[model samples]
Every structure is written in structure tokens, then in C-alpha cells.
Target: MLNEEKSTEAVSFDTEMSVEKAKDAKKTLKRLIKLLFNQKQKIIIVLFFAVVSLVFTMTAPLIFSKAINVIYEGIKNVSLSGVFNIKFDVIKELSLLLIAIYLLSSLSNFIQQHVMAAVAQTLVLNIRKDISEKLSRIPLKYYDTHKKGEILSKISNDLEKVSDTLQSGMMQFITAVLTIIGSVILMFSINWILTLIAFLTIILGVAATSIIGKKSIKYFTNRQESLGRFNGQIEEYFTGQMIIKTFNMEEEATKTVETSNSKLYSDEKKAQFITFAINPLIRLMNQIGYVLVAALGAIFVIQGRLSIGLIQAFFQYVDQASEPLTEAAYILNSLQAAIASLERVFEILDEEEETPDAANYKTISNPKGNISFEDVKFGYGKELILTGIDLEVKAGQKVAIVGPTGAGKTTLINLLMRFYELNGGKIKIDGIDITKLKRGHLRSLFGMVLQDSWLFDGSIKDNISYSREASTTSEAHQAAKLASADYFIRTLPHGYDTVINDENSSISQGQKQLLCIARAILANPCILILDEATSSVDTRTELEIQNAMDNLMRGRTSFIIAHRLSTIKNADKILVMDKGNIVEQGSHDELLAKNGLYSDIYNSQFARSITAKAL
Candidate 1:
């Protein structure tokens, strides 16, 4: 249960960090959008279309009103000549003008929308590429603390929201504002009294939307976060499906998913309710404004203060004015969602990158691999794993490191590879500080084989030649034979052409180890580190592997970490470590003579193995 608490705590901490990083992503998106507008001619063209469309839409009502007034004047037998002079024939001409205006307005709208989408999509594509490149350059520690699902969600889900905002939201926002301003001006020109009534209703509608929008912001943010957690859980379940089934924890896993699903459903329903409420509330206010405008316009016509044509124009203008207000409300909702996604993506982009300051450093070309650690101190966080550790290995010498569990043997190798920096003292290779060499060049100098061998999904030939430098198929085959892997590989159905899925391959642990060794041998590094390389093999296989190890270690500086004492009996030097300190060091025979920690460990481990075999 304590372990469960620790795991939950770890999950919570990571989630919070990711959420904070997402918030920073918004700034990155905003900067990208700003850069798009740097092209002044393109921006001007889009704005010009928007303005023209709004102007043409506002003129439609006046044209219809004039046509009605012309008919009324002819029916009343009033002096239609020079009395508010608008020719009956001219009214027909004006109707045609109104049709032309609406047609132009529709064309302009289509062009502007297309331009906006093109600009937005281009910006989003650039952002996606930048994020992918940045993620590749980051250190492995970042991945250790992050989930694959959450990272995938940012690229797929969050990035899609940003795209939506660009393609539609931004252009709609601008168009809505322009539509409202143009319609309002025309409304006032028709009837000041009616315009006030329409304006008051719009203000009330906006106030309502603003209040509800604020509450919806919190819900939207929660919804996005819940989705990220849900994705992470799904990824974990699928990756560990075999373990869960073996343990018969299917019900427990289902419950975990249900809990997350329930939270997401509730949050989504709440957010949808609020967002849906916006359109209806605005429509209701527009209906009220419509009634008020018609009532006020009727009173003005009866009082002889306004023409019937003018009253008709006021009614039409009121409806047009309401459109922009409702559209503004919709834009606000979309902006909220876009902002939520942007914040998440920015979090990853903002993380501090691994130090890349090995620029003033020199390369270790053909490094002789004389390694020395002088008073080295290291730790993970606060727990010191290695203290005052001092050791040396000459070129072409094989040194073995043996220790009880938790004695920092692996940590020492990690320092040598520069996976983690030392907290104190210095390490040197061939009389040069390892820290003073480029990280890539320093790492290229060593070949490593660990107990757990990882193979990417590829052909056997491809896996053997994973290094950047090119090697022929013949060379790969030669290396595989040296590692004793060629015997089984040649017997496989496809031999070198067989494609291996990342999962569902049936290679034994020993075979996998040999493959890893073959991969390392193909690199031909001057230094070699073998960490429990033969721990997984059977007696017969171990003998074959030992011979391969001997060939690989020839004329190369080697560091062998092993628990099997017999394997290191022929080593030039054996260092016995315990509790972050080297308790004893000498040739294997000399250590046996001392009969201290090294001898006791060897006697106990090897004696038990021999006795078990006798039984």
C-alpha cells in the first residue's frame, strides 16, 4: 500500500508538471501567429475582403426599403415627382444593385475564409515540425518522467485544436466584429429610437455570455486535463496487458479506466451545457430586440416623423446587427478551447534542454582507453551511491568489478558513459578529462553490452548494423558469427531478411544478449564495458559467450561487471565494492589469499552453485 501511495504521488507530480508546461505552449502559438502577419500585403488583402463583405451586407436593407416606398407613393397618388425624389424606375435599378452587392459580399467572404485557412494551416505545420525536432534533442531523463500517451496527445489532440482556431476561429472573430459595427451604423441612420432599443438588448446578451463564459473556462481546462490523464492510463494498460492478464487484474484495470471515463463524461457534459446555452440566450435577446424595434418603428411611422420605407430598413438592420453579436459569443467559446490546448503544448517546448556545452572540446580519435577515476563521488538525488571511489584501467587491460547488490558498480559505468555527471572529482581517458570531450565523440569511443538486450523492430541484418557508419552485409555476418549468434540466425526461415515486430518475437534471453554483443562488436570501439553479459546464458552457452567476450576484449580497455566469481578469476585486477566503497582490490588470486570480502563472496556464491549441482 505504501508503494501504491508512492506511485500515485509520482503520477500526480508528473501530471501537474505537464499541465504547467501546456500553459506555456500558448505563448509559443501566439508568437507563431504574430509572425504570420509579418507579410503585410497578405494581411491587407484578407482585411480588405472582410471590410467589403460587411459594407455590402449592410446596404441590403436600404435597397429593399426604397423599393417599398416607391410602390406606396404610386398607390397613394401623391406627387411622386420631386417630393422625397426617388424615381419609380430608379427603384427597380436599385433592386438590381442590391442583388449585385449581396453576390459580391458572398464572393468576398469565400475568398477571405480560404486565405485565413491557408495562413493558419501553414503556421500550424511549422509549429508541429519545430516541436518534433525539439523533443528529439532532449535528454532521456525527460522521457523517464513523462508518458508516451500524454506526449502523443499534445501532437495530435492539442495541435488539432490550434489548427481549428487558425482555420476558422480567427477569421470569424474579425468578421463578426466588422459585421456588428457596419450594421449598427446603418441602423442608427434609419431610426435613432429603434437603434437604441437594439443596442440595449445586445448589451444585455453580451453581459450574460461574459458571465457564463468565465465559469466555462474552468470546466474546459479541467476537461483537457482529464483527457490527458485518461490517455496516459490507456497507454499504460495496453503496454502492460500481458502482465495484467497473468496477474488476473483485468477487473482492477477496468475500474481504473471507468473512473477516468466517468470524470471526463461529467466534465464534458457540463462544458457542453454552458457552451450550448450561449447560442439560445443570444437568440432570445435578438428576438426581444426584434419586437422592440418593430414596435418603436411603427410608432414613428404613425407620428409622421419617419417614412414607412425607413421603418422597414430599421427592422432589417436590427436582425443583421444581432448576427455579429451572436457570432462574437461563438468565437469566445472556441478561443477558450484553443487556449487550453496551446498551454499544454507550450509546456513541453519550454522545458530546460540538456547541457550542450562540449563545443570547446576535442575529439578522442583512436582513444587508447586508459581510464582513471580519482576520488569520484556520485548520487541520484540525495542518496549518495558512490563515495571517494578511485580506480584505473590501462589500455588493453581487462578489469573486473564485483560487488553485493546496491554497491554502485552500475553507477560507476554510467559515469564513464557520461549518462550522469559526477558530483565530485574527475575521470580521465588516455590522460584527457572525459568532460573536456564532445559528448558524441566521447560516447563513440566505447562499446557496451548489458544484461537486458533491446532490439528495435527490424531485420536481423539491420539490427546488427545499427551504427551510423555504414557496414556491408558480409561484415555484419562476420560479427554475428564471432558472437555465436550466426548458428541460430542462419536456421531461421528468412535468415537475414526476416522482419521482426517490436512485440511478438520469440528470441531467448541468451540469444538477445548475443545479438547485442554482435551489434557492439560491429562498432569496433577501443573501449568495452560488459555488465552481466553472461548472467542469462546456460552453462554451454556461457562457455561460448566467454570465448566471444575474449575475442571482443582483445587489445581493448575493458570493464567487466559480474557476480559470477569464476568468470573474473583470470582478470588482471578485481575490485570488490560494498556500500559505495571499494573494500578490496588486487589480482583474483591475491584477493583469495587475503580471504576478506572478495574471497567470502566468491566462496559463498560459487560454493552454493557447485553444491546445488552435486545434489
Candidate 2:
């Protein structure tokens, strides 16, 4: 029973912190590259443009150096009193060429940015599309195990991180690498001694950043996972506020959320501090490299080992070499986080999907209301929930299943609908093995009204019509009328079109139950399973709905799992189940005569009703 004895798995901080950094990060990065490489043409174009921009940028410094030497040479040769013999035409031409080079570099940069932006959006779109399809393929059992908000965070938070990295982080990383490479080559060509001095300090900064980056991966992984854990608590508690209020446990819920929030804050703070801490240190080292190059170049100029023009060009190269690292500190940080998020999304995509339907699967056009469970044995895991269950219901029989909590009543229904596959048994519908039939068609034969009423963010008409896509508005209204929900629906604003969601308080729990019943009525299946379907409705409304359900179940094979034994007195047969086995089976009168478990339970309920009325 979904309502009782719920033992749920909580999101634990210790579990989130245990993410395997070395193994998973490397694997995730490899997969991400493979996914990105699928857009081979787009990547190639972006790379080509980025390289072109780097080439143009590198050439500008050299031209400026040549112009500077020309001016310096003219100054040295001329007397103080005479006109300076600077090669004005040559300097002017070099200046113009440098300007053109800068313009071209900017243009290439713009083209790459534009193209990469498109590629980024396309990559995430394809990933999100695949995720959407994968969601439909996963089995219902997966949902039972995972938290709602954790799963939602994968779609919202994790994907957004990936999208952001792809959009800007990727482009920045590419450009930064190219800038470093081009600048180093130009610096070496100008003066190897100055280049060596500048590169030593840069290498130090790079080494430090590398060490820090490796250490931050674990924290980044934990922070993202903790974010998912926090989201799970918020979603669970927010959605279950009514239960908290009913049990007067508001303070408890708040404390639980506060614990989760504190963990998130701690993780986030550590992640951010470590990620951004590399920036200032990198800048300091690069600044030292700049000053060392400047001091060394001045000595070389005095010794006539290098010209003023060459020293100026070497300074430009050093700045360009260090610039990428200075900016890339945060890009590297974001890239690490994005890679972690990518791993989470991939984990979901790689989860085992539901069993596939056989080729040319059979279908039942008009199923007779006969269901037989033959020596059925099943379990969620290794331990069996339903053991050696054998039962047969003839066509048009109204069967009531009476059981204590965890007695496998709902499990039996789940098997009949094939929501979970059996471990060692076969179930047949109308003498045909259910496994041979198409799963969708097999499930379509049964209509279900569970205790927990499910309504999405849609209109009353939409919710009712969900069972049958082709059902018309009039058909929906007719079904609603039969479920005894038509009158209250008409009283609402916008009537059948009023939207339903968690925020809406106008629709009562009884109304939600009525809507679910209306949906089942619209399905109009040959087999009906009502697991405490009328439990939420008031006594008077339940009576009216019961009368309506009896008419609807006239010829349909129905199974009712009810808590109020008075409601099932007229059932065609009553099966008393205990601890996953049927203890006794008979009509209501026969069971009462035997004075078995069913009788004792019925008497207890009767006593409760009498006592309540007397009070």
C-alpha cells in the first residue's frame, strides 16, 4: 500500500561525498568529447576560425616591433639639432598593417563565437531530447526507487550546467589554449633568453593551478550532488505539507530541511572557494613573469644583444602568453563542474530500460473478464513479497481483497497489470498468457483507481480524457457524471476547464478522488482494480459514488481492496490475505459464519463506527 509503512531512502551527505573523482571524471570527459565530436563539421569550423584569429593576433606584435625599431634607428642616427631621420613612410605602412591585422583578428573571433554559440545550443538540445526519450523507456520500478526532485535536478540543474559550459566555457578554453601556443612560438622566435625567463614563471603558475584543479574535482562533485540532495528534501517536504500539518510535524520538517540546507551551503562554499582561489595566485605569478621579462630585456638592450623594437615585441608576446591563464582560472572551474553534471546525466541515460515487447506481439481486442494467477511468486529483490499465489476469477465476478498492511494485496494487482514481472509464475487473461501480449494493450484492459489520487497540471476535462486520447468532451462529461464528480466540477470556476495543480486549494481531496474515478470510468476497461478508491470521499459522497461504481462494475471483472469492510459485504467473493498468502476465501456471509480473520476485522470496524456515532 503506497499510503502505509513507507520506508523511503533519504538523500545522505555521506553518499554524495563519496563520488569517485579519478575514475568517473576521466570517463565522463571522454564520453563528453565523443558526444561533442559528433558535431564534427561544426567543431572543425570553429577551430579553423579560432586558429586564424590567433595567427592574425600574433603577427600584429611582430609588425609593431618592426615599426618601433625603425623609429629608434632613425633617432640614434640623427643629431639632436637636426630633423629626426625616422623612416616615416615605412613606420606609417607598418602601423596600417598592424591595424588591419587587429581588425581581422577581431572579425575571426566574432565568427567563431557566433558559430560556437549555435553548436552549443544544438548539443544540449540533442542531449535533452535523448533524455526525454530515455525517461519514457525507463521502467516504473526506477521511479519507485529514485526521489522526484533528484531526478528533476538532473533535467534542470545538471543540464543547465552542461549547457553553460558548452556555450561559453568551451569557446573560452579553446581560445585560451590557442593564444598560449601562438604567443609562446612568437616569443621564442624573438629572443629565446627572454622567452625562457617569462615561461618559467608561467610554468610555475600552471603547475600550481593544475595541482589546485585536481584537488577541486572532489569538492565540485560533492557540491553538485549535494544540490540534488537538497532539491529532493525541498520537493518532498513541500509537496507533503498537508501530511506534516495533519501530523503536527511542521517543526520537524523544517529541521530536516535545515539540515539538508546546511549541508548544501557547506559544500557550495567549499566548491566555490577552491574553484576561484586559483585566479589571484595565477595573476600574481604572471605579473612576476612580466616584470622579469621587462628587467631582462632592459639589460639586453644596454648590452646591444637585443634592439628596443625586439624588446617591445617580446613584452607583448609575454603578456599574450600569460593572458589566457589569467582568464582561464574560472573557465577551468566551470568546466570541472560541468563535467561532473555531464556524468550524472550520462548515468541516467545508461540505466537499464524496461523489457522490450516481442516482435509481432499478440493483442486482445475484446478481453473476457477472466484473470488467473498460477502459482505466482514475486519480489522486489531476492526476498519474495508474494509466494506461491494461485487464484482464479471467473468472468464478471466482483472480488474483494481484505488484508493487513504489507500483505501483498496491491502487489497482486501490480502483477495482474504486469507493472512488475513475476519471478516464478505465469498470469493469463482469458486463457492467453499475458507475457505474449503487447504490454500497452495488456494494461489498457484494466482500469485502476488507486488510493493516492493523481492529477496533473491540467483541466478537469483533460485529466478525465487522459485515459482515452480520442475521447470527446461529451464522453468525458458522461464519464464524470457516472463517477458522481460532475456536480462538484460544474460548481468550480471555468467548470471542466479549471486547471488542477499542487497550488490550487479549491479542489478537495474527495474531488481529486472523484476525478480519478472519472478517469477510470473513461478508460472503461474490462477489468477494474479499486485500491481504496473511495477512501478520501466523505461518508455521504462515498455512498453515492459506491452506487455509481456498482452500476459501472455490473459485467466487469473487478477487484476491490477496501479498509471499510461494510463496503465489501455484497462482493461476489472475499479473499482474506495475510503476510502475502491468501488465508481464506469465500462470500461475505460464508466468511462471517467461519469467524475467521475477515470476520474479526469486519467486527472491529463495526465497533469503531458504533463508538464514533455514540460519541
Local accuracy of candidate 1 as per-residue lDDT tens digits, 72-126: 7766665546455447677779878988998999999999988888777877787
Q: Give the best candidate by TM-score.
A: 2
Per-residue lDDT of 247-304 in model 2, one digit per residue for the tens?
A: 9999998898898889889989999998778888988888888888888889999999
How accurate locally, in lDDT, is each candidate? 0.80, 0.86
Tell me how far candidate 2 lies from the true structure as C-alpha RMSD in angstroms: 2.6
lDDT of 1: 0.80
Query: Candidate 2 — worst ten consecutive residues by lDDT sum?
Result: 6-15
